[model samples]
Target: MQQLALFIRKEFIHVLRDRRTLLILFGMPVMQILIFGFALSNEVKNARLVVVDHGRDLATAALIARLDASRYFEVEQVALSPPALEATFRRGEVKVAVVFPARFYEQWQHGRDVAVQVIADASDPNTATTLTQYVSAIVYDHATEQREAQALPYGLRVETRMLYNPQLEGAPNYVPGVMALVLMLVCVMMTAVSIVREKETGTLEVLLVSPFRPVLVIVAKAVPYLILSLVNVGTILVLSTTVLHVPVQGNVLLLLAESILFITTCLALGIFISVQTSSQQVAMLISLMGMLLPTILFSGFMFPIENMPVPLQVIAHAVPAKWYYIIVKAIMIKGLGIAAVWKETLVLAGMTAGWLFISVKRFNIRLA
Candidate 1:
């Protein structure tokens, strides 16, 4: 116990003594959270809109007012003709173009289906879809109000209630993903680099020759990292809730427990990577390629896994972050209990067990 305590203390001192590494260990999460929360977002805002109004009637004016009032759009340009509208779109001056044909008000007065042409830049399919939906909702609401004022019979009403995220805010979706990414990168890379650095400097040989068993040495090295990772988890959660306004609707203790489990899994994988490499560069490369890429890409952190190709979807199942992300979204967004996310929890547990077993086996073989 005394030897273990001494080794853990030494590891902590080694980590704290390095100023750059210490900065990366603590600063990276804060920076990523701020960047993702403030800078990067899927929700459309201030998208430039061009209006081509030939009617110049009350109905056209009402439509223009609605578009301007929408937070998603900024009606900055009014094209006189289709050629000018095309020129605006070609020049990338506007994302959407609305054209109100002549007799738009007359058609509405006659209770006919009024045609309002909406053209959006489909270069980005997601953004285009959102813009179209926002415009369509506004038009539908205005049409309904007009009909009701004239005692016109109601048409089909489609009521959309967005569950979990009523405002469709991006922070709730991104915060949990950022948490998974930060924890995975920090735990895996730091552990792999620390172990490989020791091996490169010949100090690992001295530790191997000491009375401490090989497993005990590995565990002692990981102890400080595990504690530090928990601190990171707390920091991320506090920032996510307070600054980002992302709420954790589930049991906070459960979320922390799951985060610890994920940290352990990443640490074991890092040990495995360290055992496979002799140099710090190789360890860092493998950690980045093996953990970071898959965590960001295949884990459904930024993109929907269901939209991925079938082969890639199958590959994503092997990523630990994939399961962890799902578990987090379920818990934090949906307020689901353990019973709802039991399958993901079981998969993570299995992965941790498998990684630890393989890492222990490789460590023993290397010692031999």
Candidate 2:
């Protein structure tokens, strides 16, 4: 009991001595909550929109005015032709384009139905779907108000078309983000601490004296955990598919391969962290502070990148999890193959290589 108490005291001393680790452990959670709460909300506002009022009547103008007055939308451009509308959407400046059909007001006057066409960018299915709903609600509200005041029989209908995720099930969106967060947490944190433990307990030097090559030593340490992570990957797959109802619409083998790649990338980052920090506390701090928060914020898990401040949006590109989330969504939701995800896969490969090259170089320098 005395020995155990002494060991606990020693651990406290060690933890207290490391200021960086202490700060990260205490500060990271607070920072993450604040960042995610304020900056990462899914609710969108001031979304860039285009309007084509073909009817040019009072009712159409009033509808447009109502939409423009709302804080959720921003009228960026007005297009008169279909080709021009397509060009505006393709340029990526506008998220949704609203078109009022000809005789929009006359139909309302004659007790006929009015149709408004809403075209949304399918690339970001969540925002696109949400915007389409917003357009409908606003139009409906405007018509209801007019009907109540004027006692008219006019009906207004909204036609919605979503480009990418036609069905806005949120699971597909979260599955990829979950993959990123889990891999980063499990791979980097565990591997980093294990490696540092060997060094702290003087087992690493003993391993160096043994017959095994240092690279082999590193491999032997990583291999078992890599296999374990595969089991975790399988569990996540089952959970996501059977329990969560987010099924893999793409090749199962391809999805497995991508998971392996992402796991390897995370392991490489762990190895890099292992090389940088001598203590388990520092390694844990790096994993939590450097990996976790960014994974949630930048991966577009909670916040739409379009709605974030420009600086934060730029910083998101630096997060590898951001790319992996996109890959996961493409494979799981869109069912896209390598042809579609090659760019993201390439980016992951590059990031993995960078981490490996740096870790190996640092390890070799230490040996020399």
Candidate 3:
């Protein structure tokens, strides 16, 4: 018993001495709890809403006020023409839009039939559905109040149009998210581990001393994983189309180009991790643990980024997967062109360049 206790105490002291191990033990759980608590919300909040009120009357204004007053919506009443409204959706500016036809209240007052269209960007089916239901509920409550005041049933029909995904299937959202998660973890894990193994075995120093440049060495190390990751991308796309039936709505070649760009970004991140760490175990741990939570939580994969606190949303913008996820959804689900996703593409490209710059810089310092 004494020997066992002494052995246990020695192990605990050794664990306490390693700051990285200690951080993984104590720091990780607290961070995960806080992030999941804040980020994992099903209820909609502060969803951007645009109201096109052709009516421009008292009833329409009252309904708009009610929408703005609700916690779920940030309502903006705009006189957008039909084409401009569609362009707004394609640009991913607003989540939901309410269109009240001309003389909405006038028709209601005359006991004539009328319809108010609720248009939502349904690329993220869950959020689109929730926002639509919230709108419906609000409209229903307004109708009920009018019925009571007039002592007659004033029926107001809420017609919901879920753009890009009329049926609201789960595949369209999850497939893009899964692509982000898989590529990030796999590419980062493999590239980091391979290079770290070289370092651990003292082979990396030989390569750095070789005729080829150190930056070339790092890129060479990442090339195999890049190829493998592209294979993974192809496999995922095939399954998504064949099994899940979620077709690529945009240019296939464009989607492939974006996927390659994102893969390169992940490889650059892996190189950075490899240059920072000295052990294969540590590199693997960092690649798996470091990328997993951020990719899942901050990438807007499992949760809505807007629902998180401001600090968390700021953290999300730093995540490369968040930009890539948005790009994938735009291309794969919404059929949007490069014109709509150039900003996100630029972000991923910048991140790749940044990570590679830092990695090459650090690798040179180690060589010196």
Candidate 4:
């Protein structure tokens, strides 16, 4: 029993010495609990709602008040109409818009049929549907209250318009997210693992001693991966358009350019990881498992980022995949041009430059 206890203590001491093992054992569970607790929620609340109240009457005021008072909506009145509203939606300024027709209260008071238009940005079809449903229920309840108060039978019709994706298809929502995930995981993992493999086999050390600067050699080694990742982007795009029937609604060349920038950013990230880690296992683990959750949770594709806690929402901005996902959705789903996505594009460019700068600064020619 004493010998067995000694063996157990030795194994525990071995595990305690490995920072990586300790992190996996204790750090990951706490991280998962916090992230899953705060980030994984489907209930939408405090959604920005744009209202064009053409009626401008007492009844319309009451309805708008109710909507704003509801926990699900935060209303902002705007003087926007159909064709002009497209720009607002493209900018992601509002999730849903309520357009009260002119003389809305008068028509309802006279017992005439009145229609209220609810225009939703359906880039994320599920949210769009849920928001529309909320609006419809509110409208119905308002109509019922009005009728009971005045002792008159009149109704308010909700004409829902789901823009971008009229059919409420899932493909339009998930394809861009999948594109971001695929590019991030594939590029980061491949670049990190390939370079780390060279280091494990002693090839990287041999090349490090060569005449060329170590940074330049690292760039040379990673360039092929950048090309291959671009090819993967093209293949994914083709499959998305043909097999999935999610068309590229914006400039194809521009999309390709954006994809190249994102792939470069991911490659830079992978290079930074390879420089920091000596083992292929560590590189792969960091590239795959470390990046996977951030890309999914923060990317704003699976869950609405605005609904999360303020800190998590702030953290979402740091995830490169979030910017890429936003860019792809703007270009592909909304048919937006560079003007709409320039900020996100600049962010990705800055991230790429930052990663390259960090990787070059940290790379040491001396082998550890």
TM-score of each: 0.95, 0.60, 0.60, 0.61
Q: lDDT tens string, model 4, 226-330?
A: 665676667667766776678999998888999999989998999999989989889989998988999989998888999999999999999999999999999
List candidate 1 segments past 4 Å from native.
77-79, 364-368
Off by over 4 Å in 3: 1-154, 365-368
RMSD in angstroms between candidate 4 and the native structure over all alpha carbons: 15.5
- lDDT at residue 213 of model 1 (Cα atoms): 86
> Candidate 1 lDDT, tens digit per residue, 36-150?
9878887899988888888889999988998899888898646467777777778887888888899999988988887898999998898999998888988988887888899
- Cα distance off (Å), candidate 3, residue 90: 46
Q: Give the top-scoring candidate (lDDT).
A: 1
Task: Indicate the worst ten consecutive residues by lDDT in candidate 3.
Answer: 28-37
- Please give the TM-score that candidate 4 achieves against the real structure: 0.61
Cα shift from native, residue 92, model 2 (Å): 39
Q: Each candidate's lDDT (Cα)?
A: 0.87, 0.76, 0.81, 0.81
Candidate 2 Cα deviation (angstroms), residue 287: 0.8
